[model samples]
Target chain A: MYRYDEFDERFVRERVAQFRDQVNRRLSGALTEEEFRPLRLQNGLYLQLHAYMLRIAIPYGVLSSQQLCQLAVIADKYDRGYGHFTTRTNLQFNWPKLKDAPDILDLLADVQMHCIQTSGNDIRNVTADQFAGVAGDEIEDPRPVAELIRQWSSLHPEFSFLPRKFKIAVIASQADRAVMKSHDVGIRIVRNKAGESGYEIFAGGGLGRTPMVGKRVREFLPKGQLLAYLEALLRVYNLEGRRDNKFKARIKILVHEIGIDAFRDRVEAEFARADAFSDDENAELARISAQFEVRNYEKLSARSETFEAARKSDPAFAEWVAHSLFAHKVDGYAAVTISLKPVGGVPGDMTSDQMRFFADLTDRFSLGELRVTHAQNLVLPNVKQDDLHALWRELGKAGLATPNVGLVTDIISCPGLDYCALATARSIPIAQAISNRFADKARQDEIGPLQIKISGCINACGHHHVGHIGILGLEKRGQESYQITLGGDPTENMAIGELLGPGLAAGDVPAAIERIVGVYLDKRADGETFIETVKRLGVSEFKAAFLAGAQNEAA
Target chain B: MKLLDRNGFRTDDFSRAGADGAARLDAVIVPFADLPSTAARAGKRLGVDIPNTVTVEQLAPHFEKLALIGIAFPASTDGRGFSLGRRLRRAGFKGLLRASGPLIPDQFPYALACGFDEIELPDASAARQPESQWLQALGAITLPYQRGYARPSSIFEQRRQARKEAAHG
Candidate 1:
């Protein structure tokens, strides 16, 4: 966990003061609503359907226990006693009053957090793999670099107002847990031919109105030149990206319009010309890396007697461990993913009590730090294997022991029409219906490794484009209709899911998903995943099955 | 409109004239679109009022003869002018760099940091936000993080300097 120094503290405090003054001016009618709109948005306050939604930036999705507790206090004090975690690993409060926004930001500043750039057209909060440092397969911890980007992009003088929102994701593994190829910029830590670790950069990948997978802009960028290259990229985008239509403003659209080669050439030219970069970036990196290197583990055997005994005795505990535990970098620890996707619950919504309890659980079982996964789950990054069962019991007490990480019922969803003004249809109900349909743990296990992501609109906030079974909700003729797409994968082999058939009524979505699963089970070769089966057998079979299910459900 | 620089609010000496006006040696600024039409009067005290999207390549030839260049912000939130100003300075434009629009007090420091010599505010904003508030906003951020800006230097540079001094000591 990175702590704020005097400069960082002063920076956040000044930002809070600035926002408070803006809010006061807006209240006093000194500033018109039109003028205040971009200001509030840059501070991450959205005028949602019911109320103002304040999105707090969990920079790179890492949070200290103290920070989580402060968030809990804010949730209890201002919001509806709960907050929803977004697909970008941000926490969004759907009901914060406009008057209380400045106070809430003041509270956030009490910790080392603010909502800056969370929803603005500028470069948004940078994201990285949830399991950044502790993952067994990591090439290097990406937190230090993520922190670097966080500071550099904060209130950036040159790029404060971009054509549209830009998202940057970093990952250090071949596993691609952070949806690297689906961001505007993706930085993957890789070793070049000389065996020195550098970045393999990708550009223009985004999922929204028009989904695009990023193309490799640089084969290997030296770690030292990351910020300089990013500044060059931002400069080119600010200068020439489309501003005629707001929808066609993202850097993705620019790359798609001019083609990647020309974009690369322009960016390289700007990088060569721009010479205002800092001379002590390595020293700054060393300072940041030291914060992420605070892993303290007691020397213990790889095999935990207590963990094995609990697994052998309790079938429930064993099932939870099998689904939720990830291999850690240390021999005697396991990174536990406490799933927010409970059966028949809204995905990624955590109650204030759950936040407080989870905060305490992190301090007790793992380090005092945790991560928010892009899948809308919480991660205990360095939980000792010896304390697995005790921690599991504590988690079960708070309903955080869902044990459905990457399972069929573990769906990702947005706030949808229930909360979001942009949503055309309801997504939470659809997610709840689908999760309840596949509620049986045994059935979910039988239908293994299925991701059913639902979005209330085409903005893809739910990341439905990357789900194995992508469900997009659209309003057709005053009725909610859901479109299904198959073979969507979020891993290294990223592909935009293909549409299965015409839109089905909302009531038919879960049954349609069940039929799609049947198609996968029947068509899959031995030991093939659902995505593998969809790729090998193609979406045609799934489309046939889906249409048949629609007819049957209607009948 | 009033001109705000580090020296405080001042009166403007130049007039914004159209391309149809006869070229004179007096300080006259025209819209950037009219630069080609006014190229014949290059020896005059010519200036260009350009949008933020204007490229340095377009203005490079006129840098020698131009007395001033004003980049439009249009709206307070549109920050394309900041990068344009930085680019112009880096491209060796030695003339005055002016940010022209309805900019608020908060953006004053950023304008200065991006190589703007002064801010030309529309009359409405100049009256609405007090000059005292503008002065206060100038010192609002005593320390900024990025380098290559005007003093005080970036916080990172300060840290690096401290580290070097410590190493030698």
Candidate 2:
């Protein structure tokens, strides 16, 4: 965890004071709503359906225990008893008075956090892999670079008002846990043939009413030039990106219109003119990197015997070990994922008490550090292997010990019509129905790794585009319907799922999913996964089964 | 001949005449596209021969002859003109750098740092007061771009090295 230095602290404090005055002006009628909308949005306050929703930034999905406790306090004091963690690794409080938002921002600034650039048309919070420093397979931790970008893009004068909201994600490993391919700008950290780490930049990727996979703009950009390259790309986008139609205003549309070759040429020309690469940028990066150096770990011998004995004595513990535990670079340590989706609860809601419990547990079992994954789960990155038994006991007592990571029931859902003002149909009910359908533990284990993502609208907040079985909610003639898609995956081999015939009524959506799974079970070859089976058998078989029931109803 | 400040008090020695009278060369601020018409009228009537300049354009062409250059800020938050002022100074423009059109006193330090010599505040009473604590808290801080210019003297380098070594120790 990087503590805020004096400069960082002062910056956030000044920004908070600035926003406080803006809010006062808006309330006093000195500033009209039209004039104040972008300012408030840049501070992460949105005028929603019934009230204002304030999204607090959780940079790079990393949190200290103190910060988590502060968030719990915010939820208890100002909002409903819980807050919803979003796919961008931010948190949204659905209820906050417009006047009280400044106070909330003031409190967040005390803890080295602010809501700046969480929304509106600007460079948004930069996201990276949740397990950046602790993951064993990483080329290098990407958080230092992510922090540099966070500092550079915060309240940038030249680019505060862009054509549309822009998102950037970075991944340092071969396995794409951050879904870098679907962002507006994706940077993959890799080593070149000469054994030096650098980035492979991708451009023009996004998902909304339109979906695209980013194209490779630079095959191997030297690490020293990351900030300069990004400046050039953003300058080009800000100057020439379209403002004609709101729907066609993203950088993705601009890149598509100009063609990748011509866009690259323009970016190169702008890069030449900007003089972006200076010694100051390198010094800033070095300072940020020093703040993120790995903490000291106690040397301990690997205790396979104790772990094996505990697993042999308890079947429940064995099941948990199979799913919750991940390998670590260090010998006697492990990465533990705390699943938020227990049987039928809300996808990413944690009670204030549960948050406190996790904070305490992180201080005890882990190194007082927590990571929030884009899948809406939390990570205890450096938990010692020998302390697994005690951690499992504490987690079980707090109801945070769900032994279903990446299982069919560990769904990734959004706060749908129940909370979001942009939603057109109910997503929580559909998610609940499906979870209840697969409530049998044995059935879930047998189905193995399946990702069921549901979104209430085409905005894809739930990331239904990348799910293995994606369900998108829509309102068809005053009735809620869910459209199912098959074979979408968000890993390195990313692909958008295909639509499986007509949409199903809300009540019938779970049964339709069961039928599709049943078809997969019948047609799967030996040891073939659901994705592989779908690839081999194609969508025709599943489409026939899905549409057969709809035809019968039509008849 | 005088111009009104944002508080409706006279400050600068420039005035705008009506359409019936001939324009004077005390210094007039006009848009970039109206330069040719203003210049022709000034040459015809006042015979106050000086090069006429437009606000918010490249200053390279008028750097030598112009005594005053007006830079326009369309809105308070739009800061493109600040960069323009910096560019003009970097190109060796030492004339009167006047900021015009919606410029405010709260942005005085930033404008001054970017090389603006005078501010042509708008003539609105409500815009006269300092909006917030921005003025009270305004002070100099180390800018990211300042190091590029402060490196010619060896004494500066020695002081920087001493500070670095002390911090490391």
Candidate 3:
């Protein structure tokens, strides 16, 4: 909800001007495609399979109603009237021309938004918890820190040309909502014994060809020294990280190659060395924190009588109530997660009408704000519990109420061979088939808290490696084969899932998942979730049944 | 090679050292491998050309004798030189810093901000992106958000000043 000031506005305007010039240069043969690739990518413009996809950065996943409306306008004007929300908390338009890019950037800057650092080898758009200020488990709001980082990393002269893409995530909660351990740098806000706020830093975690859980670099770094420490860490990585192989260029490889302790030593030595540019210590931090927009939450009874009555009266609403609501720190408010996955719809795809509808609802049902989740859903961060039924009714009319947040059918998928030039096969269609297979509401509720993540390739944009039921699509022997991995977790105790034997045919994937779920249902103890059962009985127990059924389906 | 400072085109001041060594009274640019020989002669102003990978710690010993450092960027995108330049400056290298590569006009600002006094481009790159384009690129953004070599106050400090003025007024 923080609005851009004159300086920020001027900054974005100048960036748009700069990008426009770059585009002109590329058009006139002043810059080659090879030369202009990184430049265009930094502006969030990617040439996809058939067309140019324009990605817009919603910094830290927070967007104002006005900004959301503007996105709808752009989607209608430039794109094919729809936008896909990416797992990185970005929105992408699959069909945009190169000429229209600068105008689109100008439109984004009008709403205090720009696509800078959304892609490319530079430090990417910073991400944080979707339920930052409203979550019950929060220690401190991470938005201020996320914004400060965004400002500091924006056009960083020393770090703009990193060996590979760098991602940073911030969270201030016991519940890891931002996939904290899976980023290049993960910062968790904490208070020490003396009651001073600090950070617990994680370094070098990523999922690409090789998946890894980031090691904790600093147990407790003083909050004020975060930027300086990050600068030191990046300087060491810039100087020492491998550039020989493109696939192995991520900071995770460096941390894995040289042990975390050695990496930490180099970072600490650099940190203690002569400070080149001491980051805007606490002065800029205070300013951002003050501008983080405190909500004037209305005081009311803890239980909303209307919400209670609606839950008892309407089964459809009750079914949605079970999974959609997250506990808010404020007594009378609840964070409502609006699922972009509706039955068998394209996961994370939102029509222009849906965008406009959601923007309107943000003003009426909640405050004039919303947050995009890493799971490709949207969260109304601070909705009054009293307006539960009204919000649900509005959502139902727009096909936004799916009643599946963490359920079996709620999947994370990437636009694969259909759009991405890097993909081996299609991911969206597979996600659709699985969602339709598990469409039975009763079955979905029975298999609760199951994450089915699918990535078309090993880039893992869909985050299959961290998924509870990971499906990786690989092209084997000129055929699309899906490899299944089990027992992966994305929390503090993060683990990479293990492979479940050989890859399955495309048609056998849904049947294989069904058999695996059947195995879980049979083996689970009382009230055990899918991941819990997998953890308890080991993934091997379900393997025999899954492989047996998958073989039968393929034959 | 084209040598460019913030103002415009510039001529090379230091002549490249030969295999024998540098002239005692002349400004000489010696290769990294030939530094030991050149430094012993104690020229009027000694400069070394080294790859970006060389650490500031490795170069710190020669700070007193060295007057210039030309960092080799094998590719424009290999940003190790920028970080190395900053590290050298922070480690008390007061001599001139030069970024040598085929970098575009777009990268000129980053080079300057990272403590490079000038950039030396290969002949082909200089022909492709002439001095006019590079000079225009310098003024692309009159003011940027972050602080660099010579800039006193960033937008952050500017904001603080505005806030102070608001409070006092």
Model number with the top lDDT: 3
**lDDT of all the models against the reference?**
0.87, 0.76, 0.88
Give one digit per residue, the lDDT tens place, for model 1 in A1-555: 788888889989888888888888778776678777888999999998888999999999999899999999999999889999999989999999988998999999998899999987888999999999988898999889888889888877778778889899989988998999999999999998898888899999998889999999999987677888898899898888888898899889999999999999999999998664444777788888997796578888888999999999999999999999999888889999988988999988988888899889989988898999888989998899989999989888877788789999889999899999999899999999999998988888887888888889999999999899998999999999999988888888899999988899888888889898998888778899888888898888888988887877778
- Candidate 3 or 2, higher lDDT: 3
lDDT of 2 at A88: 92
lDDT tens digits by residue: candidate 3, A322-405: 999999888888999999998888988989998989999999877889999989999998889999999999999887888999
Candidate 2, residues A358-415, lDDT tens digits: the string is 8999899888888888899999988988889788988899787888888888888888
- Sort order, TM-score high to low: 3, 1, 2
**What lDDT does candidate 2 reach at residue A202?**
91
Runs of candidate 1 exceeding 4 Å displacement:
A276-279, A553-555, B18-25, B33-44
Candidate 3 CAPRI category: medium
**DockQ scores of the candidates:** 0.62, 0.13, 0.63
Superposed by TM-score, candidate 3 places the C-alpha of residue A21 at a distance from the truth, in angstroms, of 0.7
**In Å, what is the interface RMSD of model 3?**
1.6
Query: Ten-residue segment with the worst summed lDDT in candidate 3 chain A?
Result: A274-283
